[model samples]
Every structure is written in structure tokens, then in C-alpha cells.
Target: MSSENKIEPGDVVKLSGAPNLHMTVDHISGNDVTCIWFDGSLHTISHKFSLSALVLVKKKGH
Candidate 1:
């Protein structure tokens, strides 16, 4: 990913332009980032999203 948006594995992130939706970073390559999260479902299926349009989420205690 870009230096401005450094997404490491285990970091919680969300789409920069979307709200109320969140995901965790799995892997990052160049300007793309792989995120995994659950999409409201009864199957409990994990959804993987590859996006370059992402923003970082600050964890508590920095």
C-alpha cells in the first residue's frame, strides 16, 4: 500500500469513502490491500475485499 496508508496485518481498517463498514487488514501489496470481514449473513462466511481505497483506523493506546 501507499506510504500514506500503511496497512499491516491485523490492523482494523475501513473504506475511506464508506461509513458503518469495517474490516481487518490481511495483506498488502503496493497500492492494494486485502481485507477480510463478515457480511451480515447467517452462513458466517468471510468476505475478502481487495481495495486501494482504504483508510486506517487508530487503535486505542496508539
Candidate 2:
């Protein structure tokens, strides 16, 4: 990852292999990161993913 492409806590990210599903990075521990997203009913869903699996969501007009 490049300097500007770094993923930090609170940044919205998605799985690089699984597109479209947006998630937020809660925290990171070594090679794993905790992610959270809301489901259809607005329930909070969370999981830990490999640090490499996360791709930062880019803002429009960047």
C-alpha cells in the first residue's frame, strides 16, 4: 500500500475480493482488522478480516 492509501481506524472500507459491501474499520491488530457494517434491519454486523482484504472507499470527485 502507498503512503496515501493507508487504511486507518474509522475509515470506510470494503473487501477487495468482494465488492460493493461497505464496512467501517473499528480497529486493527497486527495483520487483522475489525470491521462493522449495518445489515438490512439496521443491525450492527462485525467481523475481523486480514489487513490485506480491506480496500479504502474513495470519495467522489477525488
Candidate 3:
């Protein structure tokens, strides 16, 4: 991973292996991260994933 790819909370991300899903970073701990994505109902759904599985999509707007 490059320094530029560093992930932080509030950043929008897409899994490199799963392009169809886009999620937002809610929390990170070591190599694990808590990600939240929208469901068909538009409800926030969260999942735990490896940090390495994600790539930055869009950083949160200030």
C-alpha cells in the first residue's frame, strides 16, 4: 500500500475485489475497519472488513 492510499474515517471507499459496492469508513482499528453502506431500503448497514480490502474512493467533504 502506498502512503497516498491511507484510509481514514468518513472517507468513501470501494472494495477493489467488489466494485459493485461502495461504502463509507466509520471506524478503523489496526488492520480491521467498520464500514457502512446503504441497503435497498436506504438503511445504513455496517460490516467489518480488512483494511487492505478497501481503496479510497472519495474523501469526506469538509
* Residues forming the 10-long window of minimal summed lDDT in candidate 3: 1-10
Report the C-alpha displacement of residue 45, candidate 3, in angstroms.
0.6
What would the per-residue lDDT of candidate 1 be over residues 9-46, giving only the tens digit for each residue? 77878887876777777776766777777777733334
Query: What TM-score quantifies how close candidate 2 is to the native fold?
Result: 0.85
TM-score of each: 0.65, 0.85, 0.85
lDDT of 3 by residue, 1-62 (tens): 66556788998998989888999999999999999999999998999999888989987883
When summed lDDT is taken over every stretch of 10 residues in candidate 1, the lowest stretch is: 42-51
User: What are the runs in model 3 whose C-alpha is more than 4 Å off?
Assistant: 1-3
Off by over 4 Å in 2: 59-62
Ranking by lDDT: 3, 2, 1
In order, candidate lDDTs are 0.66, 0.85, 0.89
**Clash pairs detected, candidate 1:** none
